[model samples]
Target: MLKMMTFFQGLPGQQSLLGTLDPGLSEAESEASMSEASSEDLIPPLEAGVTPDGEQEGTSKKKKSKGLANMLSVFIKGKKKKDQPRSSETEVKSKARPELEGPPPTVEELKAALERGRLEAARPVLALERELEAAAAAGGTSDEELVRLQSKVEALYVLLRDQVLGVLRRPLDAAPERLRQALAVVAEQELEDRRAAAGTRAAALVDTLWRGGVEEVAAERLGARPAGVPAGLSEAESRFLHMGRTMKADLEAVVERLKPLFPAEFNVVHTYAQSYHQLFAAHLDTLAQFELCERDTYLLLLWVQNLYPNDILNSPKLAQELQGIRLGSLLPPKQIKLLEATFLSNEVANVKLLMNRALELESQRWAQDVAPQRLNGYCHCELAIDIIQIISQGQTKAENITSDMGMQIKQLLLVELASMLRSYQHIFDEFLEKSKLLKNYRANIIANINNCLSFRTSMEQQWQIPQDSPSHLMDPLKELKAHGFDTLLQSLFLDLKLLFKKFTQTRWAAPVETLEEIIATVGSRLPEFSELQNCFREELMEAVHLHLVKEYIIRLCKRRLVLKTAEQQQQLAKHIEANAEAIQSFCTQNGSTATWLHPALPTLAEIIRLQDPSAIKIEVATYATWYPDFSKGHVNAILAIKGNLSNSDVKSIRNILDINTGVQEASRSLFSLIKVV
Candidate 1:
């Protein structure tokens, strides 16, 4: 059969189908060839017909060709029968032998094949790689072939790197399918590397392809200066602001678009998040090397320490996606501390400058004899408003940097606030003394009093400064408050002085007229009191009410109204009770929350009205209960006014009062204000 097949290959118009086919193919290649062979390979080439195009010259030639084909068929069939057992044995031996699969792709072929293309287009090259690797493993491929195969794979990955990174450089949402394809490539490469125990090669691809792509995107986005940069912002300030805006936008795109397309093992969200964070930190470190201004320093600190970590990284939508990511600070801790220190120093100086500027402006107004502005029918000044706003805003911004920074800021504000208060106090005193515009002066005094009240309340409530604890803050406030109140109410006090004098001169005879006149005088001032702020109005009213009660009792304590008769003492007690009720009604009606002072005058009247010694003793004990500051001297003074009690009776009453002493004192005391002579 072999001799006949070889002899046929040399004949004119005749060729053998098995002429060049190799029977000694390695087992693997033989199986591959067997599976891959087509029907054309099993059949002879078209008979050397009239022409290679399969055209016949004539019918005569076609008939002759038919006779020839019949003879060739008979011969081929006989040969196949004779070689059948030998062919079976050859196929069996080929299966049993281990053989090299094939030669790997040539360098030129791989280079041309691995040219940059879409990630999906690289599948053919990867298939070729698997075949070459199998050939090498079967122990039939030479070292040269193995090295060539290794080079092809390395070049293929290089192409993959370029294509994958190119996909990542575009916006995540621009071609989500393309991003998905690129990630799929990375996933396969990672799996291949893992099975081969090729450490970190897959990781390097992710770092160079995904992370490097992020750095490129971030740089491009951050370089875009936003429209209408505010006029006064430094270059650093504008850049920092733009960085925050762009970082958030890019990270959000990855989370919203790419996360769903990739699987969890890909760590798509964390990869994007960490890349953005590391790049951001590096950029901030560059910025921190310079001497930033106050605004820029604060903005830098805000982004690194607060805004990035809390508002951006932990935002509701992005937080869950980035939960697995451990992106660190936008700047190193030491750098952040330096920025904080610079910001706090600048803020401290800035606060002082603002407060001083506000004070200077107020001083100008005072020097120009400007009338204090009226707001909602009340005297108003911007001194407190401006200074408080300065400190409050400073403290708020400082806190945005850190809590410890905020406390330091508060301490700085306290010092500046104390100085401002002291300076304002002196300027106000000079203005009140020298300014000739009487109505404007009075309005300014009242406004300044309101200012002090407002300032103190803000320190205590908003700043949480303990009252009566920080003498520097509270003591200056106290002095300014007292002076302003005394100056504003000087006339009111003089009027009360005359009213009380008239009562003592009348010897308790015209109690109704004298006390009613006093009540009328205090009521007339309520409209002016109403002009003060609510906080100030209440405080002023309480002070006046306590002073009135103290003055009334002091007049009686003068011992001029000695009621020798029981009837006289009862009448006087009725007058005192009526006065106490009228005073309380007026004070309460005019917005006094000093409910503690309500019983001070009434209890004193009850002690005078009681006829029996034991009754009087019980009333004195009640007085002591209400006004724990009610002293032995107070009881003696009241008894002397009664004049019905002998020395022995007074001593017994005093003893009863002593027994009830040491009770809890009221928060605001009227008896403590009175000095019984």
Candidate 2:
């Protein structure tokens, strides 16, 4: 356009003048000189109006100008590649190829092609690979179709690798944009067709002994497994998962059925673990009663045992310590053993797990709350009562019961209690008697054990109770049946009665007066002998009083109370009638003395009965002293003193000396010596 302005304004000479004028920049003058020195200096002017006038007169030339303008505009619009030089491919030699193949494409290439085509693209890919294999073996390989196939595969692989890897990293909640777009474009019927294909693969995996590809080819393609897990586990896992789902589903059913009655009795935080354990056991136990055709007992047990030990017990270790054991307190040792042995014996590590868990549970101690649920046990069930009664009744009638066990158990548990109430009163007396014949060890010393009640309660509640206690402690009846506790209990009650009976008698109670009478009638009296005699009298008196009080009074009162109450009387009468109560017949006493006597007896006769006449020492009767041989002399003196007391008052008088062989000699000596002195 500047050159055109120059032509209109003044011509070439004027243009040169404009060009030579001092411009704002020296670079501008030098640049203009350089441009003029090149093209303009080299090209001479064309002959004026020569071939150009003929060339320019035609219509075709105008058309050609118009076409050229359109072509120039198109070229300018798409000139991005024109500025860059292109390399000649054929002139560039490729690297040496010595490929030989059965099927040319590597597995990776084949997979990429298939995935890129979505499985349909593999046929052409595989064909091209075969051609490459053939051509390589022939030492010549080229075809436009094969080249096109290779190009398509290369492009497909690049696209497919990127897309598949991206899919692999995609979050489960969302797929890639490409996949989402593809899925959106898929017609519903076409989707059903693809699903049917996936279904066939899965169906193959369902067969037994299905192996390898059956799972991978089947599960992944079908998306059967949720994540990375295999499509199936053992039969056991299936059953467990099934039962878990069933239990969860039926929970609402159970709530619906039980909510009206509120079976939440076992649902408190206080007993939640225990209630769960029991319910687990009970559900299975009850389930065992039915014929479950589809279920396996071993499997259910495995399931429950698995869940309870770790999930229930160990998961929540006691966070708060409770003062007492919160569960399994009343459970028997054998039951606990069964649990340990069956469920946890092998999992020795689980013991600590459970202990720590118990600690955790203890930490989470709930309030001692009883708002909605009562703490009462359902063991008040009729079955419990029926069982206990059966034990009680069958226990009494069984002659086959182990008779000895009762005695052993009584010795174990009740001896201290019995001794507490039955010890001789004289056991506490401060009395000392000197022996007459023995050279040494003469004195008989006694001290009271009356204030030892503390000893008694401790012996019973603490020692005996703690020894057996809540668990491993043997069952009283099981021990009874093993030990025949029936006899021991009965004898214990009887002895109590007899002791009460003995405490009440007052007749012949004055043993001192009777001693005076026997001495006066039988023989001479000794001076200063009252003191020694008084000690013996005091001991005998106390024994007689205790025996009478406990055997007679306490027992008689107890029996009378029983008869006074209508319930007791009726119960006793009915029991006796029902039992055909066994009665002991009279039998000879052991050795030389009767084991029992009439409730009331004269002192002289009682003394005679207790004495072994063959063992009596006559010299002891004369001495009026404690004999070395268990005090035969003392025995004779007491008997001689009480021998002739009247029948009406004989027992007390006889008992005052507490007649037996020792009293017999002692009494005689007292009778004779007091007179002689």
Candidate 3:
């Protein structure tokens, strides 16, 4: 029965009083008693001089007996009746705990220590925690409890963490200035990473999804909407239906973020500020064309149309839409605002600033390369037109916001157009110069076909000479004029054709009246002056002029003129109509209803008249008309050659260039113009 008391050390003061053991009790009985007693029992101690037979002890032994008696009594009681001393005498004899000191580690450090078997590092913390747990477990006095009140401490720690996370995410709700500072750091980080981070798919998706931060999140944020309202979902209900862990915020954002998300699909960032960079760099040979509405790039107006065929079919409506648009109606404020806010806000201040900047740059670019960057042919012109199309599309919906901006862009486009005109000017000067320097030894035979630049002139002479007689002047003139004039005309036609293809887009040609007027004016007047025919001083001048006007006027001029005699006019009209009918069989004028002007009309006419092929022999050197290049060299050499002439010498080697070429062949006013290296 006495041994039953030992196990109840759960009570206060229990372990100290239960130290003395009962010698008389058998080991089995003692252990069974210890095991049967609840862990919460208080055990009684044996008195120092007390016998197993319960004898009372002497005075000297009495003190020790009192200690033993106290221990024995404590061991006999269950833990429920136990009392621990305020300060244990054993604790007074125990050595004090060694001080622990180090740079404090976080919770993660303790976990790491537990994994690594670092009990020494953990002991200091474990001791402090154990002391606090023990004070609560022990029913300790007010002094012990006040020393470590953990419940209050844990509550404070939780409150602090919640407040911090809320402040970081919705910082404006707490402090606007912090958000601004954070945004500055974020922008700098993005710029630095813009190029280097292209291949990282994760970052690109982040950029796409996060275009609108708080504003979009707030707009999309679910609240406790009334359950029956259409499309309005309550926050808790949405959570319930979303299943698993996913929420509703991500689903609704799909459509609004297409463009922003597109780059991420490839995990690449294009450095271009605008789509125009695609023109030069995109693989055009393999390009799968999507023909979009020329006037509506912002909308879903694309179809599969190549540059030629579909263009030929719907060209009329396309031209009308492009040309007929009111400059003001092109751009609406809402679209301007949307594009700016959605795409252009970072780089452009507003549409006005954008247009102004473009104008300043375009003018600068034009002045630098106007001469070198000639609108060489249809290809060159199409590229320029494409750039215009992009500009037009962007500004089409930019009406009110684009006003001042549009004006600026218009000025730039005009300047670029002017640059193209200057390029044509250089080409034309090279043409006319060669025509001037051609010696009369070149038979100045005029072709009836002013239209076919490839045509040769035939000369018919009425000479009162015997069959054996030779006319030297007639022979040389006929030979030279037929070959030389044909070459010069071809070179001139090439230059004019280039300009025609470049400046005269179908968009501007619809009125027909304006194009006709342009032809008349360009044929008659030299640039920098209003005079109709003063710049030229040669037969070549008449040929160049006729060639320019004939494209527009051939059908008009080939018919009978009111100034000619009735019989002569009637004959001319008959031949002209027949030639025109033949012309329609091969070539097509680029207009609606698609007219074809014939390819062989002029050739057939020449062959009809020149019955003898031996009359003129065409040489390999004559194929290029070498007229343009030769003219440039001849003029530059002439001003320097200074009458020192010989047959084999360059000065006397009648270059074909002098035939259609001119002096001072420059596209500009010979002033300052900067160029990009």
Please write out the lDDT profile of model 3 over residues 275-354, one tens digit for every residue: 11122112121221343222222221111112211332124423332233222211334533443343223222233344
* Candidate lDDT values, in order: 0.67, 0.29, 0.30
For model 2, the superposed segments whose C-alpha errors exceed 4 Å read 1-123, 136-149, 156-505, 508-612, 615-677
Q: Rank the candidates by lDDT, best first.
A: 1, 3, 2
After superposition, candidate 3 runs with Cα above 4 Å error: 1-156, 159-411, 435-677
lDDT of 3 at 101: 67
Alpha-carbon runs more than 4 Å astray in model 1: 1-232, 252-275, 315-318, 402-437, 452-479, 520-530, 534-539, 561-571, 574-618, 628-660, 664-677
Worst 10 residues of 3 by lDDT: 448-457
Top candidate by lDDT = 1
Q: Pick out the ten consecutive residues of candidate 2 with the lowest summed lDDT.
A: 581-590
lDDT, model 3, position 447? 17
